[model samples]
Target: MLENGKLQRSLGLWAIVGLGLGYMTPTVMFDTFGIVSKQTNGMVPLAYIIALIVMLFTAISYGKMVRIFPSAGSAYTYTKETMGNYTGFIVGWASLLDYLLLPLVNALIIRLYLESLFPSVPPWIWVVSYVAFVTTINVLSMNSTSNLNGFLVIFSILLIISFIIFASIQLYQGMGTGTLFTMQPIINSNVDMVGVLTGATVLCFSFVGFDAITMYTEEAIDKNTVPKAIFLTVFIGGGIFFTASFFTQTLFPDLSVFQVVDDTLPEIGLYVGGKVFQVFLIAGAFAATTASGLASHSSVSRLLFVMGRNNMLPKKVFGYVHPKFHTPAINVVLVGLVSLFAIGPSLELITAIINFGALIAFTFVNISVIAYFAVGQKRYKTGKDIFSFIIMPLLGAGSTGFLWYFLHADAFIGGIIWLIVGIIYMLYLTRFFRRKLGTLDFDEREDTRAVEADVKVSSQG
Candidate 1:
């Protein structure tokens, strides 16, 4: 048993990876396939490839930062420690858009799936029920959440494999393209660069799970496990997205078959395997959404708890960890309340809005790497240091910036308004620069070492 105000360190590598995969929601490839395919003119796989490359560079930066500051705060902690408190607060506030809205996104997707299956039922019923269930599970304990998420993630992956097999068989029988291997999905005569770039921007939302795994650092069994988990989550999630999109795009090769492009999972399933398969696909989708809801809800609550613990938010509400459950109970409930808003928004609107904040967080994490290592630590003297601390992160930052060029207009407007609100609140928090904002203790390494030693001793005894 552990004391209050501390997250338990019980998660192993695969456990962390499971949570990451759960957060990524492997089944999302189907949900967004028709929309992306329409935008890219059946080049969904190409967009995924571009998004994966961008996320890989950012994932490298995340791995480096986690080794230095192993805290639940993630991007906020990294930015604050490396840049300054004010900037850190802004980045964290922006990241809240990604973390907070993600659970809502899951709820929205679930509502879509449920409404498709049961047309007469009201959408709010699905959203409210899902939010309540996910919140209850997350408020219990981290280990329970991880275990449940792991099972769901595995089920979702198996379903993806099933779909791929069915699609492959159809292709071999001259159903759509008649060939499994072709450049049609990657490039064709009608390929548009702008459309592909826009598709890539939207697809970036799928890769947010890799960075989200960093939030579990405080709950990980070993601090070193985080860096490895980050890489695994990125590559594994990317592989799933790319492979699924490739086959689906090849099989359909166009959006004319999908009645609804925004949510095409059901139609894809129906066309590929029939009505029975559609039911199974919906079940898989629900499982995937539930797993993602658990992971995202848990992650956002932790971020709130960390901010509250540092006095950035209301310490009494957000920072209060339940002594019995050892989880951020209040924060968990708070996220659930926010997720109720899913009853109103369109899937495309929410998705584009999420990309705004996500890109900001990704861009800064890459910059934070340079700020911490190259500028602050002066590690730019050696060639290896220059490559690791400077060049790579710069590439990451530049690539992320390129994505921003294609951000939706509504997303930019919404993001700026959120940032302005954050700026006002931050100003009041610090008394207009008259006082220093509260910060996490910088002696995390020494503290981690002491805790590890204590655990070692206890286990031996």
Candidate 2:
């Protein structure tokens, strides 16, 4: 039964981790491997390794924040409580782009994959069908959505593992690269920093899902569970990316051999496992995309719900939860409506624009950690605090700052325009700074000593 008409704390560690992995979509590494290989001179694993290192730091930073403030607002709450309301609003606005575009990107990719499999079907059909289905699942129940996500994620991982096995067999049997061991995928004489950084920026999309875990803080069974799940999600997702891309690169080391960049993995499937495996691979991609879409839908609705509950948006519309379903039905519908925009743009443009918002949010999230732990509380007792609170987050901010600086010009412009619009709207909402900001029900600070004690006991035991 629902308690006090709030989001039910139904998600345990595994379910939350499953939702995060599903959101990241392990199959995406295959979809973009060819492009990354070309940019890095076939050093896909090395670029992924670099991206993973940077992402891990941000993941730790996020884990710290979730421990401090377990709420659905995520980066917004962290920045607001630590930095200031104005700064938090800006971070929240940037996060809006990340959460909202994720589903759009997944929905668009679903249509693109379906088109590749069946060229005659209209693209809008797949987009509409996916959006409606995912939106409905989200509106009904988070538990139902999580169960569906868990099943799909397991299936997708199994398919990728199958491909790895087949690829390894082919390598041993003198196919494609004709050897199991090679260093070309990690380094080469033609290695260029610019290309590696560019590819790393693109590959960052695959790491996007881990941060979404924080959006479910209000719905988690245990506040401590969210932080552990966040770290695990990033570690597991990064492992899949590194392993799958390594084997794929080992099998298809020559980028020029690809007939089409996006279709590279499917083509390699045909070569190693023949037509049947190609069909299965396409099926796997479809499953992965669906799961990712569902995860994204769930994440964005919770974000809108938190913003609405805070009166940041129209609370009457975005904040309303269903009496029985315990979901933000209006916000769910709104996400489905906005997802229609995916039909107007190319995949490259949409994905590039997404990176801009995500990188900005990441930079601020890392900064928020420093502000909260090191500056605000001066929390430096535990040995882990020095590495996690001080050194690691600083590196995360610096690395993400570099990526933000080098974002594609189009993405930079789009992000700036979006930020400008947000500033104008916020001004109106606050009545030109004359009115104070509204707070959510769970906005009050918790007893840090008690919370930290609980977290420490949870981890130690």
Candidate 3:
């Protein structure tokens, strides 16, 4: 039940919280607001409402899944159980791309922000320095990882809250250009439904990492708290805060600002907050992205470890957890190397690939719940089952599919390539399962007992 030398349950839960908000804040403003600006024009708040509605359905699905099957390999576990092993491999493999690439991009953002604070330093230098520090922190153990994440999360939240509070004050004084609160910014006359959906698909990327609570299920104390933690983690992302932020567009009523400049939304805070508040925004963004980056590294490496243990992948690297650190030492090191190499790639291209994989995995997770419901009916289904299994999964999958259509060609191509690569690995493993994979790390006796208990209970019911 416990990983060696972990930081205990509370820190694990707190880390989940940090990872959720940290991952959300840095990219949320930068990624989504422009499209919202474009469609709704000045009514950006409406787009946030739309996104929240979409995410709420999925977040609830995640909450239900965490309660039913709490584990680090969330999408992987459910899919493998219902759809079979190979599908699970795809989900696990794709999740690695999502986890690693996003964080690496965030770290690059951190490096860029450093240029403003310390103009003398080279961006690459800052990148390397930040990577080294974060890698060291991760290698130390989950205790340190969670602790550092906690600090960063708190610091980043304060920084963001400062921006929001300051901007809200400006509105109160009637000094800003846009509305104090505008429904107008939420609609776009120019972009069609398809365009808005396309924009929303990519924008939803910022809303991820809330389910990271599932990653710590092994480390968490009292597993029942997981569903609560997962729900809470994503709850902050709803309409209110974003609606408040959308009001900031009132300060710049021209609507031309988004096209006139790149990355326009956060500037709302910077302009309204003044120079001191601007610094806070930059600091917050960096902390958020970095925290998310490290979390991605930590998370995906565990997936690698899990895959190796379960014979889904060649276990060579993942099986080699550090005796001293209780971390995926090699994978952690490899993640650092890969992230260092990955920074300069196109964001849209990378995000599309991430979404492709995540969407498929998301689809599978929904389907798995449905499968459980189907099997549950043939085998002991409850009346509430349809809500949890069929309707939610279908809704989530349908919503995701709507957005999936808007993905870029490169992301589609990249995901296809990744899938091909996983298929080849899987093919090799299937032909030579014993030779290709390493032994699972958990105690076989305990795992078997647990699995048997579930099957037995199901049979009895």
Clashes of each: 0, 0, 12
TM-score of 1: 0.96
Per-candidate RMSD, Å: 2.3, 4.6, 5.9
Which candidate number would show the highest TM-score if scored against the true structure?
A: 1
How close is every model to the real structure, measured as TM-score? Answer: 0.96, 0.93, 0.85
TM-score of 2: 0.93
Give lDDT: candidate 3, residue 338.
74
- Report the C-alpha lDDT of model 1 over 161-209, residue by residue, as the tens digit: 9999999999999977889989899988998989999999889988887
Quote the positional error of residue 99 for candidate 2 in Å: 1.2
Q: Which is better, 2 or 3, measured by TM-score?
A: 2
- CA lDDT, candidate 1, residue 319: 81
Model 1 residue 109 CA deviation in Å: 1.5
Model 3 is weakest, by summed lDDT over 10 consecutive residues, at 1-10
- lDDT per residue as tens, model 2, 223-316: 6899999999999999999999989888888776678886576887787799999888878888988899999988989888888778888878
Give model 2 RMSD, 1 decimal. Answer: 4.6
- What ranges in model 3 sit over 4 Å off? 1-12, 30-32, 115-121, 175-181, 187-192, 239-241, 258-260, 376-383, 432-461
